[model samples]
Target: MTRRPAPRPHPANRPPARAIASAIALSLALGAPCAQAGESPATYLARIAAIDDAGPELDAVIVTAPSAQSAPHHPGAPLDGLSVLIKDNIETADMPTTAGSLALAGNATGRDAPLVANLRRAGAVILGKTNLSEWANFRGERSSSGWSGVGGQTKNPYATDRSPCGSSSGSGAAVAAGLAWAAIGTETDGSITCPASVNGIVGFKPTVGLVSRHFIVPISASQDTAGPMATSVTDAARLLTAMAGPDPADPATAEAGAHAIDFTRGLATASLKGLRIGVLRRQSGTMPGVTALLDRALADMARAGAVIVDVDYTRDPAMGRDEGIVLHYEFREGINAYLASLPGHPAVRSLEDLIAFNKAHAKDEMRFYGQEDFLEAQGSTYTAAYRAARANSYRLAGPEGIDALLARDHLDVLVAPTAGPAWTIDPVNGDNFPGIGAGSLAAIAGYPHLTVPMGAIEGLPIGLSFMAGKWQDERVLKIGAAYERARTATLAVPRFKPWSPAPD
Candidate 1:
């Protein structure tokens, strides 16, 4: 889930901290069973330091806010008294937004991203930043998912030795472990969904234009969006209602004011009865256990009255290559502009400077892998090929991909396994995880995608994905809620196992 290049073409990774303001929404919407057994938000936050640092040693949280310790537990707004963790890439006036890198360790911007402000306006506490993949995993081909230069490695709460996935690794793990009511994670592609699926939580990647990208670290301007990660669909919807609104600075969000309404209002009302569901048979991966779980999920949806029909979706072999091209071109443009937009803080100012900073701090940043994607991004420029790739990729992924399938099948949403189970953490050779990804098409198309816990394999949680065309965020959530109701299994609780055996 990362990309950077100097030697080997880096894999790709997150934007910074998102905000969460859905505690009341969670309680009112779903009876708050996902809430940590009557624990107050303040109490949950107060213990985060102890839980994240010792014992299971999740390392999920990068820092904790002292103010949160004394935060009021009063009855107020919808998100009032809600505790949330921000990804380190997001700037907070009080804490350094390091993006899990040592280079921007001085990036105390003295301001909150608009998403954070929205959460605050809704009365949610800014609990502090969570560690992420270094530069959101845009450094090396073989880099570890949760290992960062500044925050070390983040472990899965389900299994200490398993992966939490990147670049929103900490946010997913923290939320799943009940370290916070919910956490915010950014996704250019798999940053949010992958980690959410990996850690057994619900992650929503709203339409890119639905949330403001201002004041956060850049990945791809076209694909990056900050969203909510929680234990339930209702909880995620609550945070998203707070996160969504028009931002004058973010041109992509010009339409957000119209489409972004209270997402939680109709979630429970969205019944599977008479709903036309399209099954992307080929896109669903072949991991036997994961496939079995997905099949069971589909059957569950069918029993609830969904009209499931198979859609033979075709893939353009070039989609992956083209997405890589677009990311490379955009990351170069976005990162340089983001660095220059910063206040007087000094360290790495551009991609070139960041590479140098990493090289200088090789003992930490380069200990596991190299910054080949940074080098690759540095070498890319505005070109006809880049433009062509962007146009084709967008068309194929959006119009000809998800949309074409829906229109042809007269379907409301598409379904698939969010991803395979979490692979063992291997910093030496990078992630060994596999998937048929319901994330990429929606991610590249800038559409709404949601993941909910389907079932667990060997005590490790995996998710079932629901996706739809642009601005169909509400529909996906409703369907997910319907599926959740249909599911016989309760939300699997993390037992903090040392490790889970491979599902045979």
Candidate 2:
């Protein structure tokens, strides 16, 4: 666990005269953009570098490649001239995939992940790599969400003092802050939806096997998949279309070619009409403010002509416990295999090596929290215990969880509050995340989950989630697009204020 930085004044509360002057100067340096004008790659990269690295010090972007300035852009490509940021865990031929760890500083493989290759073919410029929770937040129980040994902490742009959520923290923050038009984020659980919700952006976690996972740093093959994070549902849909396809390297994606469709094709303001949406009231937690917002969202859906059905998510309470057991086993095996496959000799070649490295460099790597999870994972074996855990988790979370709820309610999709507003970042005690997140069911089931900005609580954004049975990625996106269009006027842009107490 890296040490937390000292607290700083909120930009709105009080700013030193010199700091204000410096911000003004930087803003002037970044000239205004023409409406709907296409940006040159060089100009796009420079703007990101200036805003993310310099002006607000968002710490979202880890590195930008020079080749981005010369990256090909075909006029007819769907994503032509669009700038996209890759989460650091995803391999890039040009940049090191550090996964926010000092141990992987030499981990550049010079081979793009299949997903990256698809994005390039669509003419999207890879702006840079964004920081993430070190080891994708799998290192410790008390670990901070967005703090990484290699890239430091990534602060939420909405409220600088709040947590951005993990492990796709930078991807969410970057897109919300306008550092890039969109970004790629990988999730095993709450990684994509949590951050995207708190950051007031759109995140689409596609159905497992819908997108290739080749060349991505692994967490669990059972749950991991990379998806798009964008400021709008339509943009996310478009990016998903470009990145999704069948890949020979990943057999899980064997059915992807048949299911892949232009996700943006069916998006319409009336898409939600005539749809049966199950309202998951039990999952939104005890926060009154969040519940109020959720109620309003439900009313909005009713007005949109969606038939709302109340549904309860009743599942084995041990599902989470079993999921953890499966992850520990998979993390040890997947990480070791991924490390062994790196192009060249790397310092941390296995899970055991990584644990030893952390012990050897405790001052830098474990300054605030120990790698308890890593140590626990090392003791796991892929035997009967692992297989049992996986089977139990899937059965509980899938057939007995989301599937049961949807089937009983006769629902096309289930809706719930993605999460509460961002929590204050605390280094000493780690993340103080509030509210219940509707990520676990979709994550464990390897199904599609989409989160869209709902509204805000004291300037911090809340999100509404849409989830469906596996392979319903298009349905989720279309519905989310409809909701987004209906609520666009109420959505508040981030002001980057310092954290303050929520109103009672």
Candidate 3:
């Protein structure tokens, strides 16, 4: 199970600096504004070139989009001159929408997901697609987070050999590495927040349906939503403002149009003053270094006039079981529906077809882990068991969980450690998640969840998550913006280190 990576500059020797500085410095050196349709700024191209020169081309980016660059850019647009990459699962008219699976190798339908269209209207350049966890990490039980059959494994910008966490691993890593100004990532659970946390970037998973999921590869319709992974909270708001709207094709988003607002407006005066926050002490886990950082962040918030109250929310065995059932039933239905809707794929129209595809191509697709999850989803049915599990799970996670806690404690949102620092990327044994994550709480409830760079553990970044009940998207983001401002000085920038603990 041993492997080797090409050598690169070690982070320990390099000074900790903002990853975006390389791009800005290069742009200034070469003169600014490399403007043209389907072209990136002069600095970004140079920055990408630098990475290419250092080692590999198969990092985060999979397919590059030149045709979409010709899309009309309205003057005085919200995101003019900005370049953004979307997860490969989200359909783009000009790019193949592969969820890092060989089954959808050449999916091109000449249509953009509504959220992607919203981005184009906002004048953002469609950079391309980023690699993700194969089938968004829903294919196998012990699957590696960043490795994919199509795009291979994405590395953490801070540590090349460390896990980036998925299935939005590429989007998070690309933004942190300055491959793009920002990127779009879809989350069914921690797909956005986990990768964003470990990559040392800001990741926001808005309430389900706030950003349209139309034309994106499906997981669970109740939980899937597209959001932004960016360098800062303000940048996230800018992207969210453009991405949120009602899409006629997706019924889930019928009420989303009404909630759409200038998300940036909430950031200008962002503050922690008079805010009541609940610290999920039970959920934050017990990593000594991580707890110290969380303590510091909470102290900073308190010093800024915020009230911190400790809350104990114990886990229930039933929630995980129900979620499994819910996802099992949903994955079968969702994947079948998505595949059937594709322009042409006669052989890959259902989950059963996908299982067959992997078996036929086992040498490539199942080189690391077998698709136990695909098999489970294939066997699952939308029976009374599924409905009961879905309802019970929702109740446990939403009204009886986060909502109940918030109401009982008179708090605005709950805070916890996003996850432990990135584990070493090991395909042989799969991911060794060091600690627990509260992403499932918000994810199951279809509420808003955001992770901000709190601090680092031996140069590995950790995130502080802020979660609130459903429809509180702006509120959740506003609170995160305030925290980001308070803790900006301590945030860790990626140093691009190689694997540590020695590969044995």
Using all chains and alpha carbons, the TM-scores for the candidates as numbered come to 0.91, 0.92, 0.91
- The residue pairs in collision within model 3 are none
Clash totals, every prediction: 20, 1, 0
The Cα local distance difference test for each model comes to 0.81, 0.83, 0.82
Tens digit per residue, CA lDDT, model 1, 1-504: 011111221222111112122322232222222553225656565345334554456788887766776666546677887888899888777777889888987787889999998988887887878889888888779888898977888998778788999999999988877777888999998899999998888999999899998999998988999999987898899999999989999999999999888889987777999998888778787778788887888888899999989888768878878999999999999999999888986797898899899889899779889988999999898689899999898998999999998998799999888888888899889888685666789999999999988887887778888999999898888899889888865444565657756445
**Ten residues in a row with the worst lDDT in model 1?**
1-10
Q: List ranges where model 1 is wrong by over 4 Å.
A: 1-33, 36-38, 72-75, 501-504
Residue 165's lDDT within candidate 3 is 96
lDDT string for model 3 (1-504, tens) is 001112445755432345335543432222211111223544454455455223333267776676544546678999886888889999999878889887887677789999999998898988778889988999997788888888888888778888999999989887877777888998988999999999888899998988888899999988999999987888888999999988888889889988889999969688899999999998788889889989999998998889999998997878878999999899999999989888965458888889999999999999999999999998897689999999999999999999999999899989999999899899989999876668898998899999988988887888999999988999999999888778733555555557454222
Q: Is candidate 1 or candidate 2 better by TM-score?
A: 2
Q: Candidate 1's error at 417, in angstroms?
A: 0.1
lDDT of 2 by residue, 1-504 (tens): 111122334655444556544443433322111112235656555555445555566777788876877777689999998888899999988888898888997787989999999999998999889989999999987788888988788988778889999999999887777667789999999899999999888899999999999999999989999999987788888899999999999988999999999998978544678889998878888898788888888878878888989887654668888899989999998999999999888898899899999889899999989898898899997579888988999988888778888888789999889988898888779998785767899999999999988888887889899999989898899889888766633555555557775445
Top of the candidates by lDDT: 2
Residue 159 in model 2: shift from native, Å?
0.5
